[model samples]
Target: MAVVAVSAGIMPDGYGSDRCWLNYDRGFIWSFLGPVCCILGINAVLFIIILILLRTALSQMQHGPAHDKLIKMVVFKTLVQSVIVGLPWILGFFTRSSQALDVVFHVLNSQQGTFIFLLHCVLNEEVRKQFRSCCRRMTNKE
Candidate 1:
């Protein structure tokens, strides 16, 4: 593979005439598609694990507002995590077929870090409480 890669170089050719990759034609299969498949597979396994854990936990918990809220929060967070992390990579597959999809992929891929930060911090209850505490302290000092 290394020898072939050295000979082929990273120049665009054949089907990938516009964009370059490790090889070009089949490079996407090995380089891009392989990793994407691994990531998606891992996500699928994790989601299954989460469902199993949730069922056990839910069965043990008593029915109440707190229990309901916990269920909603966990479900919502899991969904958001899946979409934010998975959607862009999924879109990447069809990006070559559609200009709009390509643009959407780029947008989502570029802001992945920001999206995660927002998910973990801005949307987090503990982070929100800390933010509120800091704001109150600053305002009281003034």
Candidate 2:
């Protein structure tokens, strides 16, 4: 991606057009390469941050059955959350603004918001404890 950006004459000022792969006119190259490089750079940074977070979480879970379980749960939840949160953003990248906004609003105002709220409630220790205690008498379990 970086190669494409650089070769397409996308670099900032002081980076001459002579370095580009194709010898297109300066104005044409600038107009075509600008947005592509900008979007690619933003996506690269976001992915790097996510990778760092995952690596840190993995390093912290060194051993123990509970830690292993927690790691698995975290990985699963992260994957699900990524899909839920990123789907709209991904779609928006390829869509016109009006259509993207319509899709975003539909998802945000529907079951997606409710699912996020429920996940938040379930993950809270106090709520989980109360839920467990309430179910214990009914099932002889916790």
lDDT of each: 0.79, 0.61
What's the CA error at residue 47 for candidate 2, in Å?
Answer: 4.9
Model 2 agreement with the true structure over 1-142: per-residue lDDT tens digits: 6555665454345244564433345554544446656765676577668767976978776688877877776666666665565555455444335775766746754667776666667765668998888888779853
Q: Find the candidate with the highest TM-score and give its number.
A: 1
lDDT at 31, model 1: 56
**Model 1 TM-score (2 dp):** 0.78
- Alpha-carbon shift of residue 42 in model 1 (angstroms): 2.2
TM-score for all predictions?
0.78, 0.45
